[model samples]
Target: MLQDTFNLMPLWAFVAACGVTLVAGFVKGAIGFAMPLVMISGLSIFLDPLVAVAGIVLPIVMSNLLQVMRFSWAEARAALREFWRYIAVICVMILIAAQFVTMIPTQTFYLVLGVPVVILSLIQLVGVRFHISPAWRRPSEWIVGLISGTIGGLTGTWGPPTVLYLIALDTPKAKQMLVQGVVYGLGSVTLFLGHLQSGVLNGVTAPWSAALLIPAFLGMRLGFWMSDRMNPVLFRRATLVVLVVAGVNLVRRGLMG
Candidate 1:
């Protein structure tokens, strides 16, 4: 049983997992994405996939909740209204896709996730730019929400498409972060409910989830502290590079599996 296996995991493994969570958390705090992309991909190598996923879920949700709250309710409500259609599409797709998550072969799942992130990172790194105008809003948003939610449901990676869409929107930095936080927090709630229905949230995942919280919170705090000192451009570049590497590794794991 998963519980029996989890109980047998060594102390060092837990410690290492916590360390990784801290690093991933810091990156998440600094950049506002990549927490799951970095942590889950890395931790899965050492821990059970279920445990890894469970460990990161609450931290991601909590962090985003804090971020979303930073904006006034009026601002948040306005943002939600603007993106309501896309959010609705994403939520429905995520609920539908949740059922198939376990059926997906881990290798294939990783490949599907890794390839696009890597490509996107490379494009961004090269200064390739695409802008979304008012004319392109509807179709572009639908596409982004659909793809992002699908991937999020399957692999816990809903960041890339939404990030790309927001980038194209050319929003101000504060608003961009706020929107991303709100979307992620909302998506996390959907995922949590879906996992609960599927029995993915239970005793087996609970201990590790609790254990991971310390590192996750610490990492987030550290990242927040560093954010003011860090150059935005440098932080983005570093994040892109990390994403590219993690994406490649995921592809390799998928192919090997």
Candidate 2:
């Protein structure tokens, strides 16, 4: 089945892709986000860019469902209600932007996805926190949602912008995790559908995506266990460092490609 799906890709490359998903899942479980970023950056090193995007779809959807289930259905519903505007904008923008995915140059897509991730991750690492006043929250949500959705549609990674918006809001840690799960859960569904329309998730790629769910699930489960035993502050910083390195690697690939 795997060979039929990724006939052009070597067995080693397929194994490596599974490893990437495992690590991505671990990071998401530990720090509450970044699975797509890690998967995109790592898989693109070995797979076609569109294939990398498609490969993440199933794992992301499944991981997010697990994350959301960690909390109650009531909490998920409440989050959806509170952030409906942002969510709605993101869904619409993802559908619109996804149509152009096939038109973007691979190098341009890499730079577009990598540059912001590197810049934003560095800013957070350097202790620069964004602040949004109560009056500006509405507008900020719309703006960020649009940006996040567009980037997400293009690259299959939208956690950074969403995380930034949540940080600026000064959301409590517990609430932040729940909100991330809720937002990303819905966004993942849209991503799947958008790419389906774009032909990124057709018969050939869908099997590869589905196969990756195994490692992603295992890694995330282990990560959840580890997270309970580790210090969150330290884990988050470590995750950010990994993001910086992965982002830098993507930029390098773009420049060198």
Clashes of 2: 0
- For residues 145-232, could you state the per-residue lDDT of candidate 1 as single tens digits? 8988887776666876777788888988888888888788888788777666655556677566667778888888888888889997
Per-residue lDDT of candidate 2, residues 17-103 (tens digit): 999999999988988899999899899888888889889999999999999999999999999999999998888888888879889
Q: By lDDT, who's the top model here? A: 2
Q: For each candidate, give its TM-score against the true structure.
A: 0.92, 0.97
lDDT of each: 0.78, 0.90
Score candidate 2 by lDDT: 0.90
Error of 1 at 157 (Å): 1.7
